[model samples]
Target: MVSGSGVFVFDSSGKDYIDAVSALFCATLGFHNERLIEAATRQMRELPVYPTALNRTVPVVHALADALSAAAPIPDAHVLFATTGSEAIETLIKTTWYINKQRNPKRHKIITRRGSYHGSTIFATRLGGIESIINSFDLTGDDILYAAQPRWPRDALAGETEEDYAHRLALELAELIDHTGAENIAAFLCEPVSIAGGMYPAPKGYFEAIRNVLSMRDIPLYFDEIVTGFGRTGKMWGSQTVNQT
Candidate 1:
């Protein structure tokens, strides 16, 4: 592709194609947006890049964090920024592990669904459900567990209702937790919508049932909203849309 406008991209041969997937699912603002371009130009001129460390950060970084905290769905949200989506997800994984260890030293495992893509980092890639990516890595960790993705249509019974399917899936999670020992488990990480499995949202009441199961052992649920964030699921976050919040 040579140039783009709105959601359309033009190739070298002058063929136009719709950037329906938002350019690998992150470029939602489209291409050559005047406002974005202007902001970029201005920021580059003012402060191109700064390493936020040793208790020091640029004003724009702090401003963005404040804005995101106010805009986030989670109550009293705190923001942590990363250079890329993969790095962001990796940060989340590390943060959860750190907190979990502080809470309980044995609580080190993280449960995620099958057919979900978390990130490309070694640890994040292990948490992801894609077999191809996981296999590509020579490094392996046993703390991550895989549960079935909550796509009711693909895994539901012939006559099962959404509620029933959700409950069943939650039951499976509970069983997995029991087998693994709840005391040894950390948080359950999830993609609000499946990325590896074609962007399917969880079934109705899926989060509710999962929450019920997690509540028994005080397990926290964390959503990786890289895909279904920014009103992609008709809400600011997919967690709100799927009742995960």
Candidate 2:
């Protein structure tokens, strides 16, 4: 209701439905904001076919980069634009493997959670921890290790506290790392909150504990902020809300 645009209808039927998911939850700004519509119109009118690989530049791209940089925690966090979240994830996963290969070829595996969802691409689907995704494609990616998901509501024992549950999850992750031999793992990737895995928020101290383990093992933590970015979790970033450093 922030911008308040009425839902679209294709026929004369008066029945209308709420867009509960908001176009795969990407339309956080809601439908048809004047600014967004105007921006798209302007971009389409201007030079728009420049590909980044061709080293071509566009004013809108530069402007977006500047704005993102101004709001980013890292002043120089380079932004790689993609048409969708899946493409962005694909870029990151491949980039991670390439960079690790350059530094240490043995460190090729990426660790993720058992119930997480990255994207629908073959590699990303394999990287994700959802059983249905893996089972549907007969994916047996040995490089990625699936750690136990930190589901406080479901995984926590009857008498267990949130802090205790987080610690247990951390311990289990540490054990997995030890079993997998951290030297062979390039990075551990996850969203700050489990979104596609049912929107379950992480238990308290989960990120800090996991971060410490990754730090000790020299594994880079990739916070997939595609869903939780732009203050969706009542903060600028979910990592900041969870105190992940």
Candidate 3:
């Protein structure tokens, strides 16, 4: 049993330990933050909850959306809030399907990397590449594809430089796309830094190479920055940290 306060949590025996993982990487401001509490209280006192669907929304939701859109790297980017990261991943997956179904009906598959962990929902779990998580479910289908992870320190060839490794991985991704048929793929989803799979940051130029390939094919790239967003990777977003532009 444990109780939390600030950045520390006390165990059953009263031995306090610093929460190094930020409560599974969500509590960036730590526990018992008075400002956050005050904000929540203020919102509750005003309009605590509201639906955002069917053209219904509250001031706070619009404010959040405006802030997020302003901060996004992409011009004209919009925002959608989900209750959890899993739901967000689900939304991404569904959005990809929806867009492709309308624009390119055959482009319904998503390409992710080996060892990536997207979420726990059916489609999200299938999008993930961890065998343990994937095998637990009956999702032996082709809607999701897996490519090699760009972990240089571990996957690099003995004589390969980081640039060479990145190039090789990009080639591998291109090969996968070719084999799968670009018309059958919707997008390539990835984490700028593979934290949950392992702390495997992309090698220099890795993202650029992959982005080039995807761009030539006109396939969209989705960045799952749930863990690495909001300055977790020493930048506003891991995409920026990894030089993805």
Candidate 4:
């Protein structure tokens, strides 16, 4: 449990424990921020609950969106609010399908790396492609395709450099797209730095190589910044850290 004053947690014995996970990595401002409290108080005094849908734009909502977009690297970044990361993933999946449908109706498949975790929701979990989760829930579906994860500890062969591993993975993606017919593929979605898929700092030339392969067939490279965004990797955006932008 987190106290509003930066005090973290208390055991049954009444001893405090420092928050290690830091509220699912979301509390960048830390616990018990007075600013947050003041904002909440002010908003509660005005309008406590408001739905963003149905063409409603509350002042706080607009301010928050503007702040988020200002921080976003894209020139005209769009913001969509959701209760959880799972919801965000769901939104992403829908947005991907929507964008692809607008561009090419045939493109419907989403290529994600094995062992990656977007969220626990059905669509995100299906995109995750973990064997244990897939076996337990039968999540492997036709719409989501899996690619080999660049797990250096398990994947690198004897005498292979990290660059070589990255190249091989990119090549594998290309081969899969070729076999699957690139025209039918919608996007290659991956975390800029593989986090729960094992916190792998991207190998050198990884993003560029993969981008090159995906770009050849007009496939979109959807960087899952849920983990690596907001200076977690010491940059404003992970794409900026990896020079993907």
Candidate 5:
């Protein structure tokens, strides 16, 4: 597409199509938004560029961080900003890696659901659950594990209730953990609603069951809220929608 307006983008041939993907799901706000344009103009006129380095940050950075932390569901929340979703996810992965290194070096593996996506950065790409992307790019990693996605009807049993299916998945996860040795696992990462592979919301009690399994082994759970943050799911965070902690 050459350009976009509202939810539609125009091609070179003058044909307009609805931008259903939202530019890799990053630009939540539609194009040609006057408020966003004005905000960008105002910020640029004052301070064109600034980087948040060691003990140094611009006023806008602090203000935006404060606003994000204030709205976050995490208690005593702090904000970490990145230029792209990929960078943010990469940051999170590194943080977990660092934590595991300090706590237990053996616990370095991260388990993610099949078809789920964290980002496209080196480690983030390895964390993704899309098989095609992984195989095509040769992005396989020994420390990353893939589990089945909670795709509802497609994977559900003939008469399995949503809760039952979720429990079954949890059991499967527990088995995987046991086989791999829970002591060697670092974290469990996933998107609350799968986006990269396809949009699919987990069945109710999904996180609850997953938590039950993870808690028994004291595994940390993390979610990639790239597309579901800032009121995207009618809430400030997708964790709220999924009742995940």
Candidate 6:
């Protein structure tokens, strides 16, 4: 029903509208970009296709991997490329499971927030906290857990300051960890800015407090930046925007 150019989509009758959604938040550079077209054309001309698995990689893939790894927040962090956000999320979940299985097989549970939308994949859907999506699918699992979203406006108590709200949320997370048993948790996953969930940024100090709790318990923290990455938040990364590290 829609066709178009950068930031503007035209209907069949030629009525154009701004594509504010940006193709599910992936096309941050907009559509029909000549630079992207040229890049793709050049790459196709050089190497049309190559498998990335089993150490088979093209020059462009290596270059991109190097760039992303260099830009990663963690020191000496490696990069794993996936075709989609959902695949990347699945990779994260599997990676966490692998690590926890080595340490303590029972510590495979992942903690996410209510209203979060991870993906449509079976395991990913189970990890997502959106009720409607989960209800639509028979994603039965007990390894994923949900926590309250850090939405200050909706969840904050009367007259509570932002800092207090953040602390309260942190306490709630601590309590959840306690109830669930830190030993049973592999990682805590969330978005720096919850866009699809509710379009709300975490209150100041919210991530910091969460990080403190997770660190104390030695639980890894994973940031789903598929929607918030690449300057959507006016920063190179959402973690930077939210002062997560």
Candidate achieving higher TM-score, 4 or 6: 6
Clashing pairs in 3: none
Span of 10 residues, lowest total lDDT, candidate 2: 1-10
Cα lDDT of model 5 by residue, 67-162, tens digit: 888888788787888888889988887887888788788998889998887777767777887888888888866899888899886789999999
What ranges in model 2 sit over 4 Å off?
Answer: 1-12, 15-20
Model 3: how far residue 243 lies from native, Å: 1.3
Local accuracy of candidate 3 as per-residue lDDT tens digits, 1-245: 37788989888999989998888888877887889999999999998888999988998899999999988988998899999888999898888778777888999888999889888877778888988888877778878899997787788889999999999999999999998899899989999888777887788889999999999988999899899898788889888888875
Q: By summed lDDT, which 10 consecutive residues of candidate 1 come out lowest? A: 132-141
Of the pair 1 and 6, which is ahead by TM-score? 1
Return the TM-score for each candidate structure: 0.94, 0.90, 0.94, 0.92, 0.91, 0.94
**Looking at candidate 1, what is the lDDT of residue 224?**
86
Checking candidate 4 for backbone clashes, the offending pairs are: 4-32
Query: What's the true lDDT of residue 112 in model 4?
Result: 92
At residue 128, give the lDDT of candidate 4: 82
lDDT of each: 0.85, 0.81, 0.87, 0.84, 0.86, 0.87
RMSD of each: 1.5, 2.9, 1.5, 1.8, 1.9, 1.5
lDDT of 6 by residue, 133-210 (tens): 888876668888898888878888999999999999999999999998999999999999887678888888888899
Q: What's model 3's lDDT at 40?
A: 95
> For model 4, where is the 10-residue window of minimal lDDT?
1-10
| Candidate 4: C-alpha RMSD after superposition | 1.8
Ranking by lDDT: 3, 6, 5, 1, 4, 2
lDDT of 2 by residue, 1-245 (tens): 33335343223455455766665657777677788889888878886578766777677788888888877766588888998777898899888878877889889888888878888888888878989879988988588898888888788989999988988888999999999888888899999888877777888878888888989999989888888888777788877777773
Worst 10 residues of 3 by lDDT: 1-10
